[model samples]
Target: MENLQMLMYGFTVALSLENISAAIFGAVLGLIVGALPGIGSLAGVALLLPLTYKFNPTTAIIMLGSLYYANMFGGAFSAILINIPGDGPAVMTTLDGFPMAQKGRPGQALFTSNIASFIGGLIGMFIVIFTGPSLARLGLNFGPVEMAALLLLAMTSIGWLLGENPIKGIVTTAMGMLIATMGMDAVRGVPRYYFGSIYLMGGVPFVPLVIGMVGFSRVIGLMTDRKSAPPITERLHYRDCMLTAHDFKRLLMPSIRAGLIGTFIGILPGAGATTAAFVCYAFEKRFKSEEPLGTGAIEGIAACESGNNAAAAGAFAPLLALGIPGSGTGAVLLGGLMMWGLNPGPLLFTNHPDFAWGLLASLFLANLITLAISWVVIPILVQVLTVPIALMIPVIMTICVVGSYSVTNSMYGVLIMFIAGIIGYIMTELKYPTSTLVLAVVLSPIFETDLRRAFLISGGSPAIFFQKPISCVLMIAFFIFLALPIIKAMWKRMRSSKGGV
Candidate 1:
């Protein structure tokens, strides 16, 4: 009841003319920023942080918070309409979203993504409202050992994403891990695999690599196959894009399940929306889907989209309660809070209840605002599928170059993008799973850092992972996943031998 009263007080502050206007502006701008490939929420928030210097801290945070929250909604637009993801978390969205769009239900796919994001954000906000500080404390229990074990478990999901060829999948996964290793060592801060180039010392930039591997590679395909027809030829009306009752039923359960799972993942230190999305989608694979994942299944889209959005909301728990940044964007927001002279630790709620709660309240308003805007624009965004391959090639290629270049304002990012694009194209021709490789790249650095830290904490002893309760449980889960495929193979062989006898 007290929490409810505080929230109601927050609503009053958030509903004020200046605060509400800031939120609306932020929501509109966030969608545009998020829809543009490579300019993710981190960059978006960072770039805009300076502009909020003059506003009252409460209104300023409300605006930036709204932008961060709405970015999750906008990310799905490009992932569904094109094969490109507008942000890291949206990468999983492309697996089902683009395929579904190709199957001629682009509008429905967009609608599904929007609705799932809304549901996930709602659940995450409620959790944050009631259990924010406690959840932040829970996250503190994940030390280096536990984090390493958790990442190991996440890496095991690569096997599931590898498609039909285990060998190729393993190879690609190894390649991704190798690529991830090129940067400076996490613990020692020493550069490895740079091969004498100063640019290589920084390793590969993620935005360029992802844009290259996913977006630019598709551009290469379009350039090669210019004669291919567009995915959709018929006119699509808003009515046609609306979800049916049966579709909603399919979307609801997965969204709810992912919401719960994603919120928990988001609360864990350093496990952000991308990991949440990957984990949720992988978890969804364990269940039966109407259509198989990666082939336009509604369940796949709902799980990932919902997971990412919920994780976005859940990320705020640590930020508000403990001043710990759960993700890169959170780090930027942390900086912003400091710049505004607002301390963001345990005393924040007590010291500045209006600022803290108003930011929380604005998320609810932003969620609704973003959803409404997405619904209005889905019909228009779906038209991208109707554009000719000949025309889309150059356009997408431009986006890839601009997006990659924007990362560091250098040719190095663009160069890396081109090389990764070529490699991605070849990987496609060779039937290697690019998704597995991308996932490996995303997770390996975190895994390596935590694993090394765990070893250091244990004085190079491997037993450190088993010493901690949480780490032990996670390590056990990892080993079980590692053994499952071998066990299944052995069982099949035994059955065959018995039949022969």
Candidate 2:
């Protein structure tokens, strides 16, 4: 009943014309950014953050949220048409989406992707509306120990999930952690890694590093690929992209299931859309026994699209509940919240019910708006792919440089972006996953500060990590996550030996 009332209040706030308009604009821009390589929703939101400083808190949040979902939609465009993934989550879509496009059904592929995204988004929104308060309360209970363990779990993700080479992921994570230490020590107030440079006093700026790592790195990589292929010139047919009844029947169940899975994963802090999409793809492969998933299966496309979009909505849950960001894009939204002189969390619901609820309510309208726009413009959007690399690279580079500078207007930002670009380029060549490295970069600062704080508060005792039941449980969970794969591998080896004997 309380939830219902909060949602009702939220709807009232979201109904305003200004908020509505922001959602549409954000969704559209996000789509365009997501369609292009090297310009993901993370970069898109980071770039646009400056513009939102002028808007009201509600309007800024609505716009930022819309952009997030729109990016999810746009990611499908590259995955289907160019066999490229603009974001980590979209990688799953390329497995089947590209093949579907090549099979002369590009229109159908677009249709399913949009519809699946819509369905997934709705599911995630439903969860937010109905269970958000409870989730928020749970989030509030998390302490530094639990947070540390959670971050540790997130760090291990690099090793276990990023690529075939676990060592590279571990090395990348360590490098990020080490770099995060450059700022003043949270406990001692002495700068450890700044190396006496005044510019390093405040530490590496996050926006520049991220923009460089995720955006400029791709620009550099694409620079080398420009000579290998001519520009894409395939035109899209908008009228044919509408879903048929048959297509709807085939997509509905998978879309719904994927959305549910994605939303659940999103609610779990640090599990973003990328993980959701990957899990959905694996689920599709495992359960759909007779069907080959990576071979243009419609189910695969549905799973990828639905899971990623739903995860976008799920990412918001933490922001609303605990004032913590669950993804990099969520971090940008956090900045917007700070800019507006409005903070998120449980107190927000009490002091600013309209603001909190309104943001949540805006999502429903945003999803519908995205679906409508995608349906009408998908065919036209195809032309974006044909943009020549020479033209596109410079434009993207301009945006990257500007975005980095705008974060704090520091010249070192541009330098960091360039340095990150070089690092990114080298990492890519070495078969390292940028996602893992970026994740570590984003989380390591918070992890280091909090870990040090927790230790200081506990009089330098490591056992403080286990003093709280929640933290102990989380520590146990971390060990379990670490052991699962090793145990399975050992079990498989033993079974093989027994069979051979």
Candidate 3:
């Protein structure tokens, strides 16, 4: 009942005219950005972060939250109409969504995605609304040791889940940590890797690096690919907007289950929409005997769409409850919060009830706007898939450049974007997953800060990691995730030997 009252308050805050406008704007912008290949929500949010400085806390949050959900709506375009995924989370959608599109049912595929996403996002939002205060109460007990362990666990998951090889993932994580250490140490007031250079003193610019690796890199790769492909018009048909009763019945359970899975994963650091989507896909394959996956199964669509959108909503849990960002997009949102001179976490609700409640309220409105717009625009949105890759690459590059430069108005950032684009292209050629590298970059800084704090609090004793039950359990979990691949490989070899004998 208390939770219900709080939700009512949140709704009241979110339903205001200004917040509604913000949601609409954010949704529109997010859709446009999410439609572009390789741009993704992280890049979109990073580009928009600077603008948050100009708005109130509630307004800024409404905008960012809308963008987060809107990206899911827009991401389906490329997945169904084209084989390319608009964002990382949408990659799973492509596996089945593209196949559905190829069968001349693009509208049906997209409709499933939007509806499932809306359902999932709403479920996640409710989970947060009801469970957040309790979670925040628990998070209050987290000390440096717990934070260190949590970060370690998260990094391990990211390292394992984002790529086939954990070694490369770890290496990328280490590189990001090194980059994060370049700025002046907050505790010591001394720079570690600046080399007496003025620009180095401030550390690597996060927005530039994020845009460079995520946005510009895709541009370079696409430009190279454009040399051989003949231009073709993307054709989309909107013959179907409503799902049959059978289709709805078939998808409901999976969407709900996926929403739960996605929300749970979203609350944890290092787990984001892509991981949620994959996990939900695996779960669907295991549980749904009637629906074979990876073949345009409605279950597949429900799982991927719900899981990804739920993950977006779930990503807010840590941010609102504990001030930890669950993913790169979370980081941008967190920065926006701080930019408004508003700090998030347990006290945020107490000190700024309007801001906190208002933001949560706006989520419902945002999801509604997303669903309505996506439903209405499915046909035209599908036409976006027909854009020539050659023509689109230049425009994408321009957006990337502008976004990167907007981060700090530094020419050096543009240079960084170009350079990172080259590095990203090279990594792609080597079959190294960019997701692993980008996630590593996002988490390394937090891991370093917390690790250092943990060591300091424990008088430099390593045993501090295992002193608490939660910390100890998380550390063990991290080790298991790190070891699974190696163990599986050895098991394979042993089985082969036994068979030969």
Candidate 4:
């Protein structure tokens, strides 16, 4: 009852015309950004962050958060219509989304993604409402050891979970950790890897690095291919494309399962929507053999779409309640909070209930607004694919250069972006998992700072990690994640041996 009242209060703040309009604008912008090739929600937010500096804290959050969440839905249009992922999380959507669109049911594919996104976002939001306070209390009990162990768990889980080649994932993750260590050592007051260069003083700038790796690098790839995306010629009415009662009944369970899976993954630090989407897709593929995946199956769309959006909403919990970012985008958002003169963590709710609640409330409204925006503009979004890849390269590259400089108005940022773009291109050519690298870069500072604090507190005793209950559990999970592959490999060998006998 109390939670309901508080939610209503939040609605009051979120329902204002200015806030609603901001959300609408954000929704449209997010769709265009998501529908664009070589860009993702993270870059979209970073590119637009400078513009939002003028708004009040709540309104700024409403707009930025809306854009972030709405991008999840927007990415599906391209994935379905053109077989290109507009955002990292939408990569899995191509497996089934494009297949569905090619079957002359593009409208259905778009509807599935949007409806699943809405349901997933709603489920994730309620989970946040009920668990945010308790999670905040839990955060208070986590010390440096626990935090270090948590970061380790996230790093290992992502690397192990994503690719068939765990070594490749680990290598990329290690590269990220190394790159993150280049800046000054705050604890020791010495430069660790800067080599006395002023450009390296703050380490690799995150915005430029991410924009280059995910956005600029991909732009180069598309240009190299020199092939135009297939145009969508479907002109079906929205009603024909909308979900029927039977379709809802069919998708209900998958939506719930994916919602839960995504929310749980999102709550874990360093996990993100891309991970969540893939996890759900793989799970459904493995267990629901009755319905084969990657064949334009509605179940496949439901699982991936719901999982990604749910993870986006779920990623917010750790950021809001614990001052910890659950994903790369969450890390960017933490910076936004600081920029707005607001500190994240448990005190945020107590100190500024209105701001926190208002943000939450806006998320609810934003999802609905996204649905409306998607229905209206999906036709235009489909036409975007027909634009020549040759034309987009220069435009996206220019945006990347400008965005890199905007990070700090420094030529160094642009240089870093260019270098990162080259590295990103090479990494892609080598089949390295760049997402793992992104996660590591985002996590390394927290891992180093906390591990150092733990060492200082424990007088260099490594046993301090085992002394804490949460840390011990996390350490055990880390070891388990590491062992799973070996165990599976051994089991496979045994099965082969038995079969040969």
Span of ten consecutive residues with least summed lDDT in model 2? 157-166
TM-score of each: 0.62, 0.86, 0.88, 0.87
Q: How well does candidate 2 match the true structure in TM-score terms? A: 0.86
Candidate 4 displacement at residue 252 in angstroms? 3.8
Writing each residue's lDDT as its tens digit, candidate 2 over 1-501 gives 888778888888898889988999888888888887646777677667666666788888888888888889888887888888877789999898989888888888888999999999999998877656776677567777777776787676535555656556667778777777887877678877788898898888776777787678878888876765445677777766766787788888899899999999887766788889999878877665234788787889999889988888887776677665666677667656755787666567778888888888888888999999977778667877676677878887888888778876877999998898889879978887665665666567667767877888898998988889878877777777577657766788899999999
In order of TM-score, best first, we have 3, 4, 2, 1
Return model 2's CA RMSD, one decimal: 3.9
Model 4 residue 375 distance off true place after TM-score fit, in angstroms: 0.9
lDDT tens string, model 1, 1-501? 777788898999999999988998888777776775544666566445545665798898888988988888888877877676767899999999989988988889989999999999999998888877564455466777876786676556444434555556667767878998996997788999999999989887766776677666656765666774535445557776799999999999999999999988887645688889999999999988889999999999999999999999998887787565566577557656765788676667777889888888899998998899778866654454455667656766887777777765899989988998899889877887665566567667766887888888889999988988888988897787677666766888899999999
Task: Give per-residue lDDT, candidate 3, residue 128.
Answer: 84
User: What lDDT tens digits, residue by residue, belong to model 3 across residues 363-421?
Assistant: 88899899988877766665565567778787778877887787768887788777777
Model 1 bad stretches (over 4 Å): 1-117, 128-133, 158-173, 222-363, 435-446, 486-501
User: Any runs in candidate 4 off by more than 4 Å, and if so which?
Assistant: 16-18, 188-192, 236-240, 279-295, 338-343, 482-501
User: What is the lDDT ranking, best to worst?
Assistant: 4, 2, 1, 3
lDDT of 3 at 84: 74
* Residue-wise C-alpha lDDT for candidate 4, range 472-496, written one tens digit per residue: 9999998998788678768888999
lDDT of candidates 1 onward, in order? 0.78, 0.78, 0.77, 0.81
Q: How far in Å is the alpha carbon of 176 misplaced in model 2?
A: 3.2
